[model samples]
Structure formats: C-alpha cells, structure tokens
Target: MEQRLLAAQALGENELLDLASQRAKAVENWLLEKGHVSKERLFVLAPKVEAATEPGKDGMKARFALK
Candidate 1:
C-alpha cells in the first residue's frame, strides 16, 4: 500500500482515488476469503467525489481536519 501510494503521488486526483479504491477492495476481498473478518463487520465503502475548492477564484477555501 505504501508503495502504491508513493507510485500514485504524481497521478491526478481521480486516477489516484480509483487506484486506492481498487487496492482497498482487494484487501477487503482477501480478508473475507481468509475468514479474518466477517462480512457483517467489514463493509465495502463506495467512493465519493467532492468538489475541490479553489481559493481566491471562487471565494472558497480548502480545509482539512485531523481527528
């Protein structure tokens, strides 16, 4: 996953997300197949795309919060 992320760093947003989603799905499938986690406990999440805020252009700002 680290390697993938590093390789994908130069990719555009949509492509990077698609690659990450694919990797996540693969991991989920492997966990399910190995009985490491149950289907009821683990879920596959659908990807969501949010509009990017362009500061100074649209009077919108980008913010990220870490919990």
Candidate 2:
C-alpha cells in the first residue's frame, strides 16, 4: 500500500494505478508460473472481486473487486 502511495506521489495517481495494475499482473503471472496460486484464486479473473469495491476508485479492488 505504501509502495502504491509512493508511486502515486512519484508518478501521479493514474500512473501509479497503472503501476499497481502492472505489478498485480506480474505477481499473478509469477504465481501462475510457479503454480503457487490457482487461477480460480486470482484476483484479475472474471467473477472475481473488482479492484474498486471500496468507495474510492483508488483502492486496489478497482481491478479485481468487480464480479
């Protein structure tokens, strides 16, 4: 969370969001590659939580909080 905030400060809110998105994708890919996390448990998948579940669009759920 701190990293995202720092990135937002460094790169602006939109860029920071993109950065978080990229990071999430990277982590998801890595987990999939390593077989540590199942596709069903992945946050980016459909029928999953959207990244914007909270009132603020800045929340991480904006990407995976929507189902």
Candidate 3:
C-alpha cells in the first residue's frame, strides 16, 4: 500500500490518489460495520504523504496520533 501511494505521489496522479482515498474510506466503513467505534481505534484518513526524497526524513512523519 505504501508502495502504491508512493507511486501515485510520484506520478502526480489524482485518480490514483482518489482511488487510494476511497480504499482507505472503505476500511473505515468496514470497521464501522463490524461494530468498531471511533473511540476504540485511531484513524487518520488522507494524510499528507511524506516526501520519500526528502533527506533524513524517512518515516519521520506521524500519520496518526492520540490527542
């Protein structure tokens, strides 16, 4: 999934990004259908993609966090 996202970002394809967003939303929907509530889990949808090319910033961005 990360690979696909990276590819989509690199290609600057909005269709791919939109598709990814839909898939992510589908996961959230699936969780809700399974009786999993928001309080029981953390979800950060459509987060900013950390540039893989950025120096010394590999996997440094937090996608989800507790507040």
Candidate 4:
C-alpha cells in the first residue's frame, strides 16, 4: 500500500512539473509575440552608390562597397 501511494505521488509530481514547464513556455512565447508586435518595421534601402567620377577628382568613392 505504501509503495503504491509513493508511486502515485511521484506521478502526480511529474505531471505538475510538466504542466509548470508548459505554462512557462506559453508565457515566454506570449511575451515574445507581444514584443515583436511593438517592434519597428525594418526598411532596407538601396546602397549608396557614389558616382565613379566626382567633379574635382573624377575618382570613385567606394564608401559602401564591402569588398
């Protein structure tokens, strides 16, 4: 009888722990969604392309060129 009771108690504890973990995950996802909802929209503009010839030097300014 005591052994059976202990087994039942362990099962109940495991279920409670699992429920708590799921609840925590639900709360985290909710918070993340809310945060994303409030975030600003990101805009990707065309890269700044300098003219290959400036008025004074006639040289290309590779300011935005990665390579």
What lDDT tens digits, residue by residue, belong to model 4 across residues 5-65?
A: 7556543434544555555455445555874633243222223434457555532332211
Of 2 and 4, the candidate ranking higher by lDDT: 2
lDDT of 2 by residue, 5-67 (tens): 856765444654566567677777888888677787766642223344556445443242211
Error of 2 at 66 (Å): 13
Deviation from native of the Cα of residue 67 in model 2, angstroms: 13
Clashing pairs in 4: none
Candidate 1 Cα misplacement greater than 4 A, ranges? 1-9, 45-67
Deviation from native of the Cα of residue 60 in model 3, angstroms: 22
Predicted model with the maximum TM-score? 1
RMSD (Å) per prediction: 9.6, 7.4, 7.1, 26.5
Error of 1 at 4 (Å): 19
For candidate 1, list the clashing residue pairs, or say none. none
Q: Which residue window of length 10 is worst by lDDT in model 3?
A: 58-67
**How big is the positional error of residue 14 in model 3, measured in Å on the Cα after superposition?**
0.2
List candidate 2 stretches off by more than 4 Å: 1-9, 45-67
Between candidates 1 and 2, which one is better according to TM-score?
1
How do the candidates rank by TM-score, highest first?
A: 1, 2, 3, 4
In model 3, which runs have C-alpha deviations exceeding 4 angstroms?
Answer: 1-12, 47-67
